[model samples]
Target chain A: MSRVCVPRDAATLAVGADAVAGAIAERGVEVVRTGSRGLVWLEPMIEVETVAGRIAYGPVMAKDLPGLFEADFLNGGEHLLRLGRPEDHPWLAGQTRITFARCGILDPASLDDYRAHGGFKGLERAREIGPAATIAAVTDSGLRGRGGAGFPAGIKWRTVAEAPGETKYIVCNADEGDSGTFADRMIMEGDPFTLLEGMAIAAFAVGASKGYVYSRSEYPHANATFGAAIETARSAGVLSDFDVELRVGAGAYVCGEETALLESLEGKRGQVRAKPPLPAHQGLFGKPTVVNNVLTLATTPWVLAKGGEAYAALGVGRSRGTQPIQLAGNVRYPGVYEAPFGLTLGEIVNDIGGGTASGRPVKAVQCGGPLGAYFPPSLFDTVYDYEAFAARDGLIGHGGVVVFDDTVDMAAQARFAFQFCALESCGKCTPCRIGSVRGAETMQRVMDGVDTEANLALITDLCETLKFGSLCALGGFTPYPVMSAINHWPEDFHVVRDI
Target chain B: MTSLEPWRPERGEEIIAGLTRLDGAVLPMFHALQGAFGHVPKETVAMIAHALNLSRAEVFGALSFYHDFRHEPPGARLVKICRAESCQAMGGEAASRFLLADLGIDWGETTPDGAVTVEPVYCLGLCAVSPAALVDGQPLGRVDGMLLVEAARA
Candidate 1:
């Protein structure tokens, strides 16, 4: 008999999975394991193969299981929850799936389930190739850090691996403090073993004996999931050589930065440190550290498992590999969708996201997190890539695209960008600390129509100073939203000038 | 005065005593004290200083550096509204205004009844839903003004 796989989406696994298992078992069919498809709303998405295709059903609750079973639903009988083909669904069809390749395809906590669906193949491959060869594979893949800052991942590993030190560390920045971004949280919670396998590979590559996952305290579920995953990995011998521990952060936005994350991990206040000596040299208690975002490290094992060229061939221009793009807010289909770098903002916002849920015209889409720039409807055609976004005064910040309808106020948004920086500023430098508060005040003046022209000029100058003088992006890129809002939606600013 | 009287037994004394025995315990002691009593009380700070043989100023500076440490007590319900970009992109401003208007208080201010204290949080990692907010540290996503009020009331 053909084995069928049914996912436990949002509801309790035993209630949902057991019912499906019991129903299928009664038919003398075997049941298999798989992870969630990340479309949380359409949960308990059941998949069964027939001569026609892989039939799928979703939003299936425990109460509906008996009816589904009575109809022999395992063999793809017509039901209210029936979705003909899993791959044919527009939501799943458009995704590229690099970091989240195994999600919804394997049982999250099961190592055996993972291995069956291409888990640890990267680690096993890394073990054969050795550290140097492994690093070369990543370098060839052209994989940049997916943690907002698009730094080369291989070069970072090389620095830590080559660093002449006995005590090295691998720190995963699971402190995803950016709004409109839950890729890290989803990866950790849904498919934690992949991240564990990836981190273990990094530990081996960097010759690091210890690894730490600095997860945000805001994601209690993610923290619990990661904590449990670490324990499971340790007992399963996957993390036998390297010790992995999870440190819960007390919900600080600045902790998302690599330097600030290290400070937080050290049990100090989450504040950004000056970088002359990068974390590669002085990090995590003054040891050579391989600090990478969750997505960056999660992609490592895959790079080793598949050839670097295979992964490199996926994206356009300087950007390579697939990004776990989160399609969130004011959209009909708000969920995680993976795609290559070449897709345009219009395609993502309209095509994939199915436009705004409000049925109003799409006004603007904010690419990246809080520090990212907001693109007006005019620039909707702009391609979604690192270099393209940077050219347009934006960054593909952690692949977060927040859609906004015409109801959004550009002036308020501009003011909020400054306010956010002021609140999150680590106060390591004056430009960020003093400049942000000044920027907020100046933006407020512009909004209030008090000396509007002078206030705009002052805000522009302040942004420049903060960009040039600040130590990190928290201060540096705070102006992206401010300038973009002013440039695109000039009418929003209370300027006295007549056309 | 009666409420303040219970604090005379060195409010966080048990926690302070437990943390004091560890090696390099100064930092851990302060953390434990803060964990026990939302913020490090003056008496607890003094006791920690005496136990760790560190100055009161040293303990105070440590307390001041961390954002989690607060000088005043939090309300029975702590509502943290996400001010991050995604939340902002999804009508967070309107939500904030509605909350302020409905509650008759601005962000970081407590209601007159001492029932709820609303503060602005950068992000709660519920970006997909957008316009997210948290009440008493429990995350609620895709929130509106009515939702915030309902959460506050609940």
Candidate 2:
């Protein structure tokens, strides 16, 4: 029987990959369920082992099974759904493929598969070079946190290493609550061993004996897959003396914040704690902790294996290394496009994304998540680097690019930014808690043509308060979307004014 | 999803006992209790507090802080629709409206017959597929109101 590969990634599974896999297996074929290739639109894409390498057919439903079998697709016969070799596809070919190098290609649960794909090389290298050198390598790599903060990963590790604590912890913030982002989830479900290896290296470097991956409850598939990978790594003794546990977070967006995540891990309410002691100095049960995002930790393995300078060679300016930019929403080719920084927004939203899925003119794109700014097509020339985007009041937060066609309502979207903050505010700070609700009401009055200009002014002032007064990014960043909407698409806000 | 058993103090205690020794066991205990009983029954708050050596106020505060831990039993199946920006760009609001209107109920409300309860979830990381939903914890993407209705009914 020929071996066929199918994605078990949550998005593909949601669209019926299981049924397609079952149908293929019913033909007495060996079906291997792997993670998604990040070519999301062609999900349930099956690859067959052929003399010319793996040939692909995709977006396949269960009903296509009989035809596929009849076409003798086991040997990569020509079919309507055939897309030739997957790597040759423009989408996959254009990507840099650093952190996500082995994602869709390997079976996440198999430590052997991971090893064969250059997995634990980083950990081995870290061990060989010793702890200080390992930390130095990451420091020299110029790698910053991919969790939107853009903080240096090596500095955090060094702080934890130097901090005074008998017991320290490594925490992986896998709580990917961003609306258009799924890179962390993809990595966890597709290449879990990489994350574990990275964590192991971090634990070794920081002198931490325990590590915890704080994941969200919404990611049931990722939690299950990563949990199994943890068991496999433990059994294989790859974790060595370091112990890692997967902790699930209840549905609290605020918990995605580092301090709140530590609070949630401590079995307390998911409330944000003030900074001064920083997580690296005192965190996670009042011990020095290294809290890093999933992407930040996962990228460590590559940084270690390839040498820090090699990893640093790519990406423009300070945003070194590749980012798994998630192209989503109304885009035609919605998938993770792993590339170096400096690609213009226009190129990403147009060339790589293939424009709007609805065949309409693209009006706006929201980078980052709910707290991100909305960029009109006018600012499409902005570069993808963190500092570059920040220069334009935009951010490459988590590298999520959500496209929207002309049919979208920026006024409504602005309102949602407030409403979402109101619904999810941790209630620790008064500005985010009270200001968000007030902002939502004012936006509603504007939408209803009641004192539109005055309400708009009030919103601008309130956004200022929410931006600077809030304790954390939750309230602090909410104004980005609100003000961006008012600035870029002012017509949407003025549509119902004083009629 | 399997049918949830009626809330039992013994079963709750047993679940709590298995995880009480874990560091920060409250959330896991809450999850287990919800798994068995469909929701964290009010009675188990005191039991969890006692077992974990925390105050009832602290336990309730923790429980109430999270949206996942419900205080009441849901319908036979739980249906969560995406209401976040990515989904909205693809007409999630319209689909959500269609489903809610069809069911003659509002968000977070159960159908009259207790067949399904619809809730608003921000995102399920299915933004690429758009208009996604979770029926009894199983994800479905590229959905419309009709599709969600059919899936929830199924």
Which candidate number would show the highest DockQ if scored against the true structure?
Answer: 2
**Fnat of every candidate, listed in order:** 0.41, 0.75
Q: Alpha carbon lDDT of residue A138, candidate 1?
A: 90
Clashing pairs in 2: none
Runs in model 2 with CA error above 4 Å?
Answer: A497-499
State which candidate has the highest TM-score: 2
Interface RMSD of 1: 4.8
At residue A165, what lDDT does model 1 achieve? Answer: 83
DockQ measured for candidate 2? 0.85
Please, what are the lDDT tens digits per residue for candidate 1 over residues A118-178?
Answer: 8888888988999999888998999999998999999999998999889999999998877
Candidate models: Cα lDDT each? 0.78, 0.92
Write candidate 1's Cα lDDT for B1-154 as tens digits: 0022234445576777876654335445554554555545666667767877878786665556655555666667778887776676678778888988998998788899988788877776666556777676466656788988988878
The RMSD (Cα, Å) of candidate 2 is 1.1
lDDT of 2 by residue, A332-435 (tens): 99989999997999999999999999999999899999899999999999989999999999888888999999998888899999999999999999999999
